[model samples]
Target: MPFQHPETTGHGYVIERYVTRKDSDHPRYLELNGAHVLRPGWPHAKRFARHLIDDATTITDAELEALLAYEWRSRLTAAWLIGVDRRESFRERIGDLLLASEVCYSGGGFCFALARFGTHADAEILTAYLDHYLPRTDLHYDQPDALGALLHLDARLGTHHADRITEPDGLWDEWVKGVGRLGHPSHTPAELRRWTDLHCDFINDWSRS
Candidate 1:
């Protein structure tokens, strides 16, 4: 029998289970640049991240392209791998995918990759994403992740690229209200940290409960 795409099953656990595999950690890639600390599955996530970064030279561009062509999980993993490796040649391709926003879940990976690139061009791509999507409050697609990426870039580059969107009553504010209506309002530091790392707190709480 042939392997099936996890998303096709329409079962979230099936998808989450797929996350533990070596090649793809969709939705979260274990922040390569994150501050080192302990958390649930931190050892597991960190190990995979280190492996990807360590073996970056061995991963061929052809392999990454194939990953990008597959489902969101593969695309997510590809983005992190590309970013960590500093594969400048793939930057445009990643940026295009980020702008397309064709699929769900993988956008976070794209954002992380672009942020890793840490170039003004990468920041522009992130800005363009927020410009186009933040106003579409009903869609709720990766706006926060893009914004987070932009802010991360700004801090690194000493640029204020994210200032306009974050102002009171600006696009970010509008998005917050919309998200709040759906009971998903928080974007605090702790909440934002989950975007980069495995949600260890969530996992611990879930397992205990």
Candidate 2:
């Protein structure tokens, strides 16, 4: 089902399509009489995304989306939208592309994004990414974000380690394991403790009222 946001007009439709977004606008966007137009500034990525959102009914539209896979933005857009369609092919392709990206870098916000449509294999892919790069990361947010993704996916799988959530080191041990869990190699114990607290603060209300 589409996510309901009663606060906004068009509700879930607004999140489904990227039309009203000013954040992703190309810097070179054209304006005429206060109207937004232009082929380049308004990218095909958004249009293809619309097709996915509006439920494309034609083979040609699907064909075009397949061709548009050349862009990472499209892949990211599709990765998020695939949950609505639940197309296994879309999941496989998006998951594969996302996995490739994750291998090169740590899972930050992208991990949470991937976790939204996360399947079992996607969880494994993310787990591999976090298990490898998270320990090696110096980025302050990498550990929490990576762990958040795993936790999010695990929540669905009934395997979440939220039991250990109150314990700072317990959270870290799952990802880094052994010596690095306490933040010696990449961070300090104080820092890990702060992250653990923040994680609880978020998870406490993540799916709660």
Candidate 3:
């Protein structure tokens, strides 16, 4: 049965109310919510996934693999939920997700969510991804959304070398602005000032062009 949000009132009220029920013994309670519903297609999957995670039910390895195949948005939500589990299964799946691509919202969210774990292996994996995939100035790097993902991961992973990543007179400035929205440490006052200065210079040069 699909889990419903707690605040929902109607035919689904039973499902909705059960979501927040504090009783862990309930047979229907799941450990991980089905985030697939709240995603673009279902719009209720997120609540389901949350309910499942909160319930503490065991998530099988096969189920985890199926989740990884979802689209970026759903995958990101799944990753965040999986990180909450703190299981070896979750860690392995998340590692796979990181290598797949540079998903903006999900990748960024996953990085931030997993940051609290602070495991050495996880850190090494994220750092390696940045080292291999982030240094180039291609469409992936130039994309503001993608840049936001990179910056979020960088902040959580404490990645340095902002100088190497920024393009002198291109969309790098805009990317920084997008990163600012993530509320990561990279958007600190000093960092913001640095980005602002670079952005101003880039805009000035653009006007002259």
Best by TM-score: 1
Q: Residue by residue across 3-94, what tens digits does model 3's lDDT show?
A: 23323332223333333243333222232232222224434434443464553235444444444454454454455445545454466556
Please give, for residues 64-149, the per-residue lDDT of candidate 1 as tens digits: 66567666776776776676666889878987888888777778778877877779998899888889888877777788778777
Whole-model lDDT per candidate: 0.65, 0.41, 0.43
Q: Judged by lDDT, which candidate is best?
A: 1
TM-score (all chains, Cα) for each model: 0.72, 0.43, 0.44
Candidate 1 stretches with Cα past 4 Å from truth are 1-20, 23-41, 188-209
Candidate 1 has a TM-score of 0.72
> Whole-model lDDT, candidate 2?
0.41
How do these models rank on lDDT, best leading? 1, 3, 2
In candidate 1, the residue pairs with backbone N, CA or C atoms under 3 Å apart (3 or more residues apart, or in different chains) clash, namely none
Off by over 4 Å in 2: 1-52, 55-68, 102-118, 139-146, 161-167, 170-209
lDDT of 3 at 179: 48
Q: Name the runs in model 3 displaced over 4 angstroms.
A: 1-58, 102-104, 139-209
